[model samples]
Target: MAREGVTMPATNQHNEQASATPNPFPEPALEYGENPARFLVEELSVDDGEGTSGELMLARIRGLETIELCGFWLAVERALANKESREPRERVERAIRERKAELEEHGEGLAQTEMTPADRRAVAAERDAESVAVLVDEGGEEVSWSRQSGAAVGASR
Candidate 1:
């Protein structure tokens, strides 16, 4: 089943294949229990072929956390859709909302990002000003909007 000119590499003691050439993109060392579950962005750049540079970013998530988050979100969706799961769904939703409210109160916002609060606000304001379809509630607070859903989020500090 081996293809012509395609030879399998010899495995080392760790079961990893021994390569003749060193890998440019070596694996990053990560500790699971040391850090909380989160997303990390590693930004790179490439030429756009028009004298402009384009961003190449990596949104890195650890293996276990990825699976756990996917499972949790799926369960939440299923529970919300099923009438029989109303009680459990409500409790879960309430917890999430409360946590979100607490985070907002503490000015943590949601998730970790590299951008400072001021920078984020500036970007949000720029986007809102550029877009004619920006959604604003009756309170008219300046908040960041979701890129995908165009929904207004928590007010900026």
Candidate 2:
């Protein structure tokens, strides 16, 4: 029986229709090995909104589809009784998570930006002066300093 205004609901397999037309979404490009999975964010229970049932306060949630307790699945009454005394714990956890993420993200960039001692010295020398002196042992192991400034042979003469 169908209502006048409301149409019939979809089938259990929503995508399967009688007609064999082209599917808008083909098979996924990447191969998913056996036992596929989904990514989900779990938010702790707050205010009056609770877990599976309104009465069951969620301690933690595992996955998107299969949401349950963080570690243990507690009965609604037990969970409500064992609720957090205060919400400061969540804030500390949030700060640690943010800092960890920032470090992980910037660690590589920091490594890349760092220069070796030799490289740093070369850069500093380039910035400091246009010429440098090369000390040579010319006179029977006697050290002699000579400035290398691209100076001309005429000046030497």
Candidate 3:
């Protein structure tokens, strides 16, 4: 089900490969027998508690291509810079700078990491075995994700 006020560009994975026109956001290369590529582009409508609204597009990409990932990060940085609020914009900018520094130092090892066919199979099996549930605090201001057990396993901000 699609969310209200958010639109996704229509794309067929199979057709994407054959098209002469390159996709603005293309999927990263995958290993043999690896799972299909999937990414998310979220447009958030933020209400300032007053009538005014601001919007931002956040992209979550998973791929092996470092250059394409950097390009996507640039897009996200540009979007965050254009946001109306100063707080979130500054926070995200700082985070991006910190992350870039960290990546610059350790990215060589990351670039070398690759998933084997067996590793992909194990990941798929693990995903299939796990059951996930979202839990909300009493005031509904905080949320967490729990596995099969009701106890909170990970918190989401």
Best by lDDT: 3
Return the candidate ranking by TM-score, descending.
Answer: 3, 1, 2
Q: After superposition, how far is residue 73 of candidate 3 from its true place, in Å?
A: 1.6
Worst 10 residues of 3 by lDDT: 31-40
Question: Model 1: runs farther than 4 Å from truth?
Answer: 1-82, 98-102, 105-112, 131-157
TM-score of 2: 0.16
Model 2: how far residue 35 lies from native, Å: 42
lDDT of 1 at 109: 31
Residue lDDT tens for model 3, 1-157? 3344432343334565333222232332221111112221222346767642322322222222233344455554454444533333443444445555545555511333486545656776897776564455554443534323344434432
At residue 28, what lDDT does model 3 achieve? Answer: 27
Q: How many clashes in each candidate?
A: 0, 0, 0
- Per-residue CA lDDT of model 1 for 48-131, tens digit only, reads 565423121112211222333333433433443453434433433443445545444434433347875566667768977774
Instruction: TM-score each candidate.
Output: 0.22, 0.16, 0.26
lDDT (Cα, tens digit) per residue for candidate 2, span 14-71 = 5644132222112210111111111011233454544433112221221211111211
Q: In candidate 2, how many Å is residue 14 off?
A: 71
Model 3 has a clash total of 0
